[model samples]
Target: MEEKKVRIHLEKHYWPDEIRARRKRNLGRILALVGLVLTFVFGWVVGSTFATGEPVEETTDFAKLEAIYQIMSEDWYFGKDVLELQTKLIDDAINGMVDGGGDIHTSYLTSEEAKQFNDSLNMGFVGIGVQYYDSNGTYIIERVFRGSPAERAGVLPGDIIFKVNGAEVTGIGSDELAAKVKGENGSIVEIDFLREGVTVSKKITRAPINNTAYGEMIDAETALLEIYTFGDTTGNEVMDILDDFETKGAKRLILDLRDNGGGYLSTLETIGSFFVEKGGILIQQEFINGTTDTSKSSGFVTVDWEKIVILVNGNTASASEVLVAALDENLGEKVTVVGTLTYGKGTVQTQRPFSDQSILKYTIAQWLTPSGKKIDGIGITPDVVVELPAIMENGFEPLEEGETIAPDSVHVAIVSLQEALSFLGYDVDRQDGYYSPKSVEEFKKYQATYGTTVDGVLTQEWISRLHADVARVWHEE
Candidate 1:
């Protein structure tokens, strides 16, 4: 296969730099105190006041901590290299301090983790573009980006990733698998995946991925815009789509934010301005210091719509929820939210980078909708609730090539198979895991339509076809 060249785009958001500068300035006094403590604890000097002439209160907590460190470093029999042990001890102490706060969002990231986190928000990485979900320990591809190496290499949605670069991926976390798959641009990654009970390996070249939003005309009058994330260039991508929609005379808009985890807050504000009028409040933030801040639209209404539909699912969260709330509140009944409840992530986090390039991402405030409704644990309920089929949510179970669920068979897997058939418009009598005569009839009908053998028994080939057809229809819709 011929490899296609990919262009990489980099656009920095201003807020990250601003936050870093502000954090550095504010941490000056704290760092000075830390320096004084270190100097006193190491027996460099004993002083009652700080170097800047501020009276410092004496505390024994620092001495106790030093004593523990000394015992661990000098007396512990299993201790390894002194320098390596010291680094590990410091990293653990920082992690323990952050984890002790009882907030899940507040985290301490090592230098490598910090880089990956920032790269994710900026969409700045080279990889075989794909999004996956963790099923127990197995990773299943949920989406394959258009024109990406994965898609070009015959990777498809619903495929089970078995290995990456000859390493078995079972029992591995999603992040670890992703780290294994991603590499330098033009590098080849060997991916082994399970498709229709068959494991196939493909060597795909890594490429820079820039896609965040995709738009298409659903009909002459309706446009469908799906945003995967709100990265740095999301605002610009949204504007270009709106421009095309205007040119095509699309009046009804379907903004699909399903599974969008969200990115920079500045991108949210910029995109929000495209719909909400200037000075209209989009969100309200309540800081830990008992202060509140309001974020308003920037008066950049690029286009107006006759009607709008915002599609959200359980994965829609954070900045995505903010946009849904803003549009629904400001646009009145013209905007409709469909799909299941969104992910409740109302807290705001800010990252401060250390001199060693590690980062501390701490929750600074909790955000509220424009209506002052707090959705921390409570997600935003959709106007029209639409739940996906169980089979789609919890993937299909793997089967051997000749395995067949005969007519009158009753098994738990039959329930999902029935659901999959029903979702594909098959008239299965019931979804109760019983392969009744009617269920067999529906299965035969599906097989005949797809040019498969018209056997009543549900074979692995039929199951794979059914899953692929359902996935295709779901993507189209």
Candidate 2:
């Protein structure tokens, strides 16, 4: 058998001790991610080759394959096409990655394989399937979709795949891994994974993934929307939600953009256009030649600008950040953003097809807003910041070390809320230790002014505004 070798390029730089330590910690997380995104790809390769599939009469045909490849390389000449050279090279490289798997969830694809693998994400697949990614690597099956083949096969969320049909699939990429697991409908794949620290093997059929990101509100004006990514349909979904809200007399909106990573930039641009008025910048996009252009809203052609209050957190990234930043900048008077700093991702990426089977999607440019604000590494700050609940506020959830909020919380929160209301120009009674309907009503009135959901609940937003540095009074300004 002919052996293949790979060359890895490294950027020239000296690493610090802290960076090394951080990398060490990041390694496990990254591998775990590989276990998810690449899990399917690894599973297919291992299962097809192993997993009781028309049992192989002979273990492998690498020798025969090598002979065939040698003949193609030497005889089958399209006259030394450089394109042909790269194709052959990429094919060898991908096969090597798949064969090097340590777990069923990890597999490598050649550029072509990677393209087929990634495109499959939008095409077809099934099982109690879930997909996720991180800086560490790509992941899958955080939560199995209900009624999926994987779910019926007893696969639970967070079940880590260490192998598939005896092939170790650790550290595989998302594009590659997705390619591995996805097959034509009615195809069967065997997956070996660890659940609750116990190793298990299961055969599951693949199915199409039907995902929805919008969750409707019942009694409250706040609808919990969990966008997995900003795809081509994302803008339409958002617009539909806004239409629903307006139809139901929703004067205030809380856009929950937690844990959503970015996808299509066009979706963000479209969504931003719905909220911002026309002829104004929504985002500043730079072209490859260094020419910068701004994506502006055609107008407030969809929803009212002042009615949205985008809720963000550490996991909110990419398209989510774009929407949040746009609303924050354009609807400052109407929007009262709350939650933690966002996952700042202001870069643009485009996918370019190589061959019939492979494609490459790489980041092209970093983005800025019309105001020239950068959101790349430095995340967007919330207008009002509220720390996550250290422990259950009602003291009911499981308690662990370093979890519980101190006893001084209630007094502190009440005092802060009172102070914040005053700072935001609420005419509430002075510094009252108690929360009465009067206080609540006064907070509601202030919220009404800024278009927050007027449930009359003394939320952290109200408390935050109390603690904020007051802007000058309208008359004075």
Candidate 3:
């Protein structure tokens, strides 16, 4: 008898540069061939129709679209140059058609937008990689990715971001601020941060960042794995972490998918294989034509865990929800889902690229769980619902420096302060945005314990201290 050899395949992520280069080269040849064929066919059709003198039947609703285009080209007074106007009209037509489909996810993207979309999924954006949260009007750095430009530039968590590129970020949305910070890979961004009552400035060079999954041992037998997105590298990242957990004698698992919006379907299948047995249904898709397709596990079980806990929140959507549903249903009683309800985005979309390098990403199917439960618009309910404090969920109003909310003062900030104080084990009479005498007493107690001035006045410094303490306790928990 001959000995048999088995080969195990691991998914590897390709760098954006190589992937884009290869795509452009192949697409260039394809577009050239397609253009020649389309030109010849269109010329022949027009010539034959004109020669026949027979009316072209309007079989489809859009059959007269070319006539409408001709009318606009010939008669529209405000039309720009022929080529530019044609391009604009074609893009507008595509958008109108897609928008009429009534699905928000099914839309078109320009060439540049398509590139950014792909980069987001591949985790290959060029920027100072830092995640921030809006504290009232102030943006605070919540997380600085390790080995990133921001981390190298001494950007620390809890630092208040004041300005980007000399423009104040006080009134801008987080997305707008991020756009101002991100640029070409070699470009430099000037960031002003308020740290410990001092304004700190840093000039950081942006670079490509690739990060998704992270893991660490939480206790003797428990391991915590946090997956930010189901990107191309996520499978290998999860595998390495699970292997490390096994080596450290950890059996219980806590998979955190809190704000993960999700990414590629292929990555989802790869990660799903670890928890689900081979041939088990991971997800089912029902297409427009009423055909159904099933995705099964690849049978690459990495760890034999005693128990698994999945943490989710409202922002946990799409592929993240798929994983939670698959594990909860397939693993039966062994898996537990905790935290708030997930984001309901259960539709599957596929993209088609145009000759212009633009893309049309349209919904093709609606996904169902293993037990055939439709998750579209109806999110997966967790076994344990652990809602965050109201103030934490909805951010608090910021108090300016030297501004204090004294005793008997009624303000919305008082409500937030009371909530934070209550969460930190301080005794408070009311959390209704009223600074009553009882609230003042509790505030003084907190100040005394934290070694701040024992005055019964709320300052921005005190709020900052309270915020830090709240964050520390939550992190430890």
lDDT of each: 0.74, 0.53, 0.75
Task: List pairs with backbone clashes in candidate 3.
Answer: none
lDDT of 2: 0.53
Clash count, candidate 2: 32
**C-alpha TM-scores of all predictions:** 0.73, 0.49, 0.71
**Winning candidate number (TM-score):** 1
| lDDT per residue as tens, model 2, 161-222 | 55654665645764456556666677777777643334678887877664435646655555
Q: Residue-wise lDDT of candidate 3 within 225-255, one digit each (tens)?
A: 9988787788898999888998999999999
Overlapping backbone residue pairs in candidate 3 total: 0
Give the TM-score (vs. native) of candidate 3.
Answer: 0.71
Where does candidate 3 have its weakest 10-residue lDDT segment?
34-43
Residue 21 error, candidate 3, Å: 29
Q: Which candidate would rank higher by lDDT, 2 or 3?
A: 3
RMSD of each: 10.6, 19.2, 9.9
Q: lDDT winner between 1 and 2, please give it.
A: 1
